[model samples]
Target chain A: MNTHAPVFESVAKEDVAWLGTDPIPATAYYDPAYFELEREAVFRRGWIQMGHVCELPEPGSFIRRELEVLKASILILRSQDEEIRAFHNVCTHRGTQLVEEAAGKQSRFTCPYHSWTFGDDGSLLSAPDFEQFNVAKEDCGLSKVHVEVVAGLIFVHLGTPESGMRESMGPLADRMDELPIARATTISEYVYEIDANWKLTYDNFQENYHLRFIHPSTAGQGCGGDNPFGYPEEYGFQGPHRTQTIWTNPETGIPSAVQGVSYMKIGEALAKRDLMIPGAEKNYFALFPSFFLFGNPGTHFSHVVYPISANKSRGVIRLYWVGDDENASERYAREYGMAMTRDIHVEDRSVIERGQRGLESGALKHIHLQTNEALLRHFFNEVDGRVQAYKAELEAQGAL
Target chain B: MSVLPEGYEALEPFVATYAVDNAGRRAEMRGEAPSEVRDAFYAAAQPLLAPALDYLDTKQFADYDSGDKQLMWMMLSLAHVAIAVEIQQEDEERHAHLRSFMPVTRAPADF
Candidate 1:
């Protein structure tokens, strides 16, 4: 039997025209003022995916995350009752940072400046000369922040949340629960710090229009047949979040000998665990603000962009695996998958940095977007809507 | 004593350059290596990837001694080199600089 069918048809411009064809303001990508508004309006109150539940496995396990965007440090851990929680990594004694180590297992944290001890549940266990201070021990617990785990991904909110991340995600939350990440027991990570705006850096990945040019050699297999650029077959939006069904050319015939073996090894590993369900990798999730999760079962990964400032951001890409490497081939497959993906990501940096430099020069008032770049357009629209609403709220209060 | 297993003696020359156990150091070696060095290793090991994996599959991981560990580490290094030679090709010189920003902080093999 012979079958010839088109894998994808171009998503028409008119289908997404309601998002508007007007050029998006370039200033939003690099402007200091707009960045300030986003910090307050969007990031401050919204849920940011910064860590995974696997990082905090036991009661004493804790990891310190530096939230530069909020100028705050967070200590996420599992308490004695086996509950996961997040707290301001600040000691209530005198505002000194409590935990300094990046990650470790510790039940008691004693402030080095003064040996004020705190328990794993953020309770003030002891302070020297207790009667001398007017504060009660109950009032001295470390400041608490909202932390929730959905699909084994840890998200934290710095300010008051009108709705939690899982609630906000709605149906996408149930969909995410079925993916590989929900069952991940371990992870491999690669991190990059780039001198580009967070949106510009994230937008680089949201669209595949530049794949053939920017990643000519590494991305050859993904681009061919009807979709020369390997564009997504379909795009679905839910509130501020979105998902895309990635398309792949089944017969590009470019997998190197070692690369082919590595993928086959990974495929077998997934198949043994019954993770190779057909269309299991149907689509990937891009949570609001700056987070992305690929749907590929063999290489289940999430990329999050952390904003350090207007023109500087750090991106951490983590590949979640269900268990440890069982044998030589499994280990080799993980290495090849990681190294190949890293090379593809490396190709995107210089071009995105160049894009940021061009935008900063203040030459272009706005930037153009084609039909295929609808995801970027949607992200910009959602972000600007929030920022503009926050500005209006401030003006109403006479605080702007 | 040989640096690799009995059947994989041909890969002994790469033991010193690619047998580093840490993922960070292995990736650094790939970046710092010159074109001739990377190309020669790729040409040498390209044919052995399948056989090497097949050979290692014959033994349990815990039973491996020093020679087997070295060969295993070398094959891991081949993963990085294969991408450089077969994919990046002539663009490696510029690609190396781009990789400096991204570092492998954690992997399953690291533990």
Candidate 2:
């Protein structure tokens, strides 16, 4: 580690050296065997970010999400009691897939294949022939999945979670609760399927070293003068989770004409709600094992990477807005904000796919990481730590 | 009935082309328009951005007459085109292909 205590507006190399400066094994990113281990170790016990609570506003509102990593389809809903819950999207009888529509309002789900129906609360409600099957009605209810809502975001645990996300997140959850997402009644969203590992896609957003080269247009004025690479001014760790204090651009004058007006309108809307102030609110959160919220009230966006296979993953990006547009100016501002963010994202796609192809070739056994990509290193370590421990458990049981 | 508001008669030609009902459809139009069309529209619409918004700001959404509504929609479409003209430029063509994968599924503007 270079022992430089950063001068003025720079991050110190030694500050994150304890995470190690060694070349990480390239196989973890491409090997199918390693991906399988991660499904159980990392994805199973973690409180995965599914969607926001705003999606299910009231009783009977529901959404169906397919989690490919676990080979499960989840149905999340707000029941009559006004409690949010998740359950198997499969019917109890013959396991037919229920809820063909992605989202809607309904208090009951009727299986098209067998006519078995379930209540909003996941209890068995009806059947066509009354008693041909030898199972109790209570036993035929949909399987309940572990779900919890905190800070207006919903999370689900496939396995027994040691702790809730809010408790585990500590102060990060509280800070997020204060962001616009917590109060959001609506959203702007887009989704993409990528030819890369989940970690590879997730890592693309965690570090800033690639910002200057890959996102020149978006990063040009944003990267402060002293910091050309646009690296975060500070790095933080909270258990397996991480945070980065994004470098604030001290204004090199307003952007191009229409773009400038868009930014001004967005700032005014945010200021009206008293959320445009400067503080640690600029910090971006990387909630493991696969969610990042680049939250600042003005341009807050969250991205979630869901693993599809060893060589593929899907990303869902969203901008959570506090309320519906009150006028044309606000509408214009939100649309511009989304289009600009999407422009930056599309530019990074080809580069990320190229990186995945190089790793999949089986040529490199190890990949190097500099001090700037510390968050990437920290993520790999945390993921592998669980994989190795899970391997050890299997070995002790003579299953390996 | 006029396609556009009285003062904005200069933009009448673009009214039929860009006056779409929803935000996502407007976003698609940004990518599908011909290069010459993009050039002409960008040249015509760039200077009027602030004034159009200023006009729309005077009326609450519920009270918008047909001309006011059409102008508002056109201005929203311009949000996408301005980036293509100013920032992305020639790169916008290739970028549009990658953008198709991430469709704008939901937006507050859609409502």
Candidate 3:
């Protein structure tokens, strides 16, 4: 392959003419007030991805998720009517906590608190001494949360969203729907509690610029060869969300050992269908706030960050595959992908923690993003814009 | 699955057992929805509430006493109710949103 022409031009700030060249303030990452504002403005109002629909493949299947930052314990399940629903995992009676298990299959949730049993549809099925209740059974049903499925991914809105999930996702809705996410089953989930601002963790995933420097041995070798990892093949916005398409260097050849144990070939052969992203080995889609969808050769996964507080955050990297792992090569390939992803993340943890400590030390006032980090700039712009709008709304109501 | 530390498995179920994840700082409850009001709401739904309380009280659970067990349980319980209230509040808001979109010429369909 002739390496004469650049496959893609690196993204520059000037390319995004509306986003100025100003550096993002350090306070955006470390300040408590800003964190609170983000909680109220961005997280509460945004259409956030919760999990994949494949997680509960059958009716009566349920899973519990705790969003500590949003202060929510969500019970997501498929009801008897074969509809997916989400509800608060609290027993309405006596305000006792309900559904102790994290994930299970059950038609009814009996609040161990007072034995208030509710159907998978969130309807109150039975309660002790029911006739004496002041609140009617209809009113006593589990409180429902806003949940919608796009591209086989489940998204929940914490507050009354200004628009529907599809509208909120904007142009990415089509791309999301095209993804093989619904057909993929979760294979592994890794959780890391990093001592860094949630945004700091977020900033790490939006670009491949760090692959060469931060992941020289693992990702750098796998993605590129002698030449530096080039900029993404595409960089643009789908509403507030951003997408980056990456191609493996044509000249980059895997080692003989890699070829021998390669799982990609196996996965491709066994998969019923592949993701629709054309000519790209990988695609990075960053949804507003903290959800990131990464499409790989024969698999896909999501990196979701939930801020626990200003300085602490939780990171979940869930891996999914379309075909059976029954094939040895598929298993090997999936394992290879997991090992590589984990290594890259492990490298990131140290750097991001250091970033937070440095920002907190007050040594630097603003952090400069490079030309390739156009997505970071876009993210900060959206966050700042939303924060400003939230402030204005509060001021109008005289609540600020 | 890898076996956890001696009491780690036992304590895993208790993690965020309460609805610690909140939508916003006052959550589903609007301004000044008094604690007494919430208590009264609970009192009226005792049939649904008592079993959950009994489970928490009587269940043979691991002792994280050496590792802040009491504090963990308290947060989980409070978080549970905190989030529950948010759910109740948000459902009403969702119904209202749907109503605004559809024509109200006819009676609502029974669930």
Best by lDDT: 1
Q: 2 or 3: which has the higher TM-score?
A: 2
Q: Which regions in candidate 1 have their CA more than 4 angstroms from the true location? A: A1-3
Going through the candidates in the order shown, the clash numbers are 0, 0, 24
Q: What's the distance in Å from true for residue B45, model 1?
A: 1.9
User: What are the clashing pairs of model 1?
Assistant: none
lDDT of 3 at A47: 76
In the range A262-369, model 1's lDDT, one tens digit per residue, is 788888888867777577576779999899998777878899999999999999999888877878888888888788888888888889999999999999999999
Candidate 2 lDDT tens digits, A7-112: 4366677888999988999999999999999999999979898989899988999999989999989999999899898998998888889888899999999999
TM-score of chain B of each: 0.94, 0.93, 0.23
What is the DockQ for all candidates, taken in turn?
Answer: 0.82, 0.78, 0.01
> Per-residue alpha-carbon lDDT of model 2 for B1-111, expressed as tens digits?
567767777677788778777877887888988878877887888888888888898899999999998998888888898998888788789878877777777788777
Q: What's the CA error at residue A161 for candidate 2, in Å?
A: 1.0
Clashing pairs in 2: none
Could you estimate the TM-score for every candidate?
A: 0.97, 0.96, 0.74
Question: What is the C-alpha local distance difference test score of candidate 1?
Answer: 0.88
> Where in model 2 is the C-alpha error above 4 Å?
A1-8
* Chain A TM-score by candidate, in order: 0.97, 0.96, 0.92
Instruction: List, in the given order, the native-contact fraction of each candidate.
Output: 0.85, 0.79, 0.00
